[model samples]
Target: MRPVSVRRTVTALVSALALASTAASPAAGAPRTIELVNLGDSFSAAFGTGGLQQVEGVDSCDQGTGRDHVDELGSHPRVEVTLDAACAGYTAQEVEDLVSTKPVREALATADVVTLTMGGNDIGWAEFIGTCSAAAEAESGPAPCDALLAQAPARIAAASSSAAETADAIGTESDARIVVLGYPNLFDDRQDSPLISAGRAAQLNDWTDELNAALAAAVAEEGAVFVDVTDRFRGHGVGSADPWILFAPEAGAHNLHPTERGYLCGYFPGLLSQVARTR
Candidate 1:
């Protein structure tokens, strides 16, 4: 047997070596998968994308069926889509209710990221468009459409309030990184036809800008990221020869929504850029 002093010294050296080896070794666990939860209205619900054609009477918007920008996020290596709570035709108020669903709440508890697109429906965008288009068809001056939307300020205020409230509600249940996406302008600025005059188009675009600003302020106040896709959609609005937005009064099913190419190239790029920044 070795001398007691030699043995004790050897033991200390061996123990130190073992600890050093362990410290130098790579960690032994797999990378944690990011759980992503999507919540909001039609934009998130994939509204006009895919090949969803119109049905006679029923809602052509496939509601929860379409896959929107969430699919883009899930394509990232670190992400897994845990819940997609978005639905067609849902307002901000409706989204608040969606977040209250049992599965959605449960998903939020463990979610690493949550993305939302709301407020458009709350501001009654579709109705506003219908009214404005009708005025345009009548060849009325910008004043008629302007007067029709005279109550816009009040409506915008209510939309803003509801957005902030929804953000607060989401924050309460989720510690996840939240992203709120803003809508793009439906009309471009270049040319003006007799119908939907330049002034009228500008007015419509202005309201959309206001809505985005409100959404940005509300989401920022709640410590969430607000992504504006307006610039991304530039040169590709409703009247552009290669418009990203689909617009045909008869093709009501996808009238105001982004086309598949628009979502993939336009919306997806904007969203992915934000995700990269956050990561």
Candidate 2:
């Protein structure tokens, strides 16, 4: 057997060699994979497009359809989607509640990024759309539509306030970057559908612009990034030959929501661009 000092020095050398080997290995120096958490409403959930599938540890109401912008982002080789808390018909308050849930809170703690798409339901966008469609169809006079339009500014302000509060709530739980996505204009004013006149479409687009502006301000105030998809969605509104928005004559949950292609092409690219700039 070797002498005690020689044995000790040999053991130290062996340990140092092992550590050096590990340090030189590719896995040891590789960047950690990014963890993304999705939170918001139907748009983030990709409702009415991909078939419903239950996500483990997620609430039944928050099941993912596997086709939302979150999924698109998750497809990146370096990113892993740890949680998707978005649900159809969820308002800003509902999303806040989701963030407070134990599983979501745990997920947020480890998240590197969080993406939110909300405020539409908070501002009664669906009802406004219905009113606009009815007016365009001549099923009712423009009074109801006009009234809803008049309410838009105030409602948008209130919704923007809620968005800021939600961002604060999210910030408290995670150090992740928060990305808020604004809704796209649902109509192409140049190509009007029989159910929606060009004038009505233009008015609706203007309302969307107002909403986006308010949301951008709110998000900025909260130190979160706001992604505007309007440019990506241009020329692909409801009346376009290749529309990205869903159009239904009867009132339904899916109407005016982005289709699968819209999420893939519009929301994903817009978000990716913003994320790259920040990085």
Candidate 3:
């Protein structure tokens, strides 16, 4: 029989060898996964594309219809979406507020990557679209659109500042790689809308460009990557032969939002391209 001291020494050696082996090779079937967190407003929430469901247990947030870009990204083999904090109607300031909330704060603590889409609401984009649509329906000239355009520069500046602040706050709370997405043009300038003229559509598209530029600058200010989907979405706006954005005659929340195809094809590819380049 082995002596007790000899048995003890043998057991320690075996345990050390096992531990070293375990450390050298990960458990079978366990692949490295990236923890992704989604944060922002309607664009990030994928408001119009899918069936409404609660997000992070918040009924009002409507996050889990599975058609959002985050969901598309989560479908990636290497990614696991740990949190979806995006909510419709949320502004940049509101997203900043989320950083202080327990759920978002905890999620950020372990996030490997964070994606944000905001600032459109802060600049009254929805209202601008509605107002422009109404004027077009009334056969009114571009005066109303012009007035809104005149006010847009200041609003864009404010929204850009707010976005920068929000990005900074998110960076402060997490070491995650931040990717911000810019809004796409809802109208194809090449075609005339039944309600709005081609020139007006061009104007709206131009405004979208301005908004994207401002957002890009703001994201850069906070060291976040800004992924622009405009190129991907070109010729796919409301007036295009094949529109990716939802268009409804009556005003509602989902109008102007991307469809599932839009998320899957346009936004997701744009995001992937940027992430790949950065990585």
Candidates in order, TM-scores: namely: 0.80, 0.84, 0.84
Residue-by-residue lDDT tens digits, candidate 1, 1-279:
323653454345334433443443458854345678888877877777645433222233344234446775575445588877676777888778767767778989998778888898888887677667745547655465667689787888898789888888888999888888899888875777433555567788899999999889977888888889988788887777778887765655566788765666567655655544433
lDDT scores for all predictions? 0.71, 0.77, 0.77
lDDT of 2: 0.77
lDDT of 1 at 118: 89
Q: What is candidate 2's CA lDDT for residue 97?
A: 84
Q: Model 3 reaches what TM-score against the true structure?
A: 0.84
In the range 117-179, model 3's lDDT, one tens digit per residue, is 999989998777766774554776667778887898899899999999999999999988899
| Per-residue lDDT of model 2, residues 206-268, tens digit only | 988998899899878878889999998999898898888887655255667787777767787
Steric clash pairs (candidate 3): none
The whole-model C-alpha lDDT of candidate 1 against the native structure comes to 0.71
Off by over 4 Å in 3: 1-31, 57-59, 64-66, 134-141, 274-279
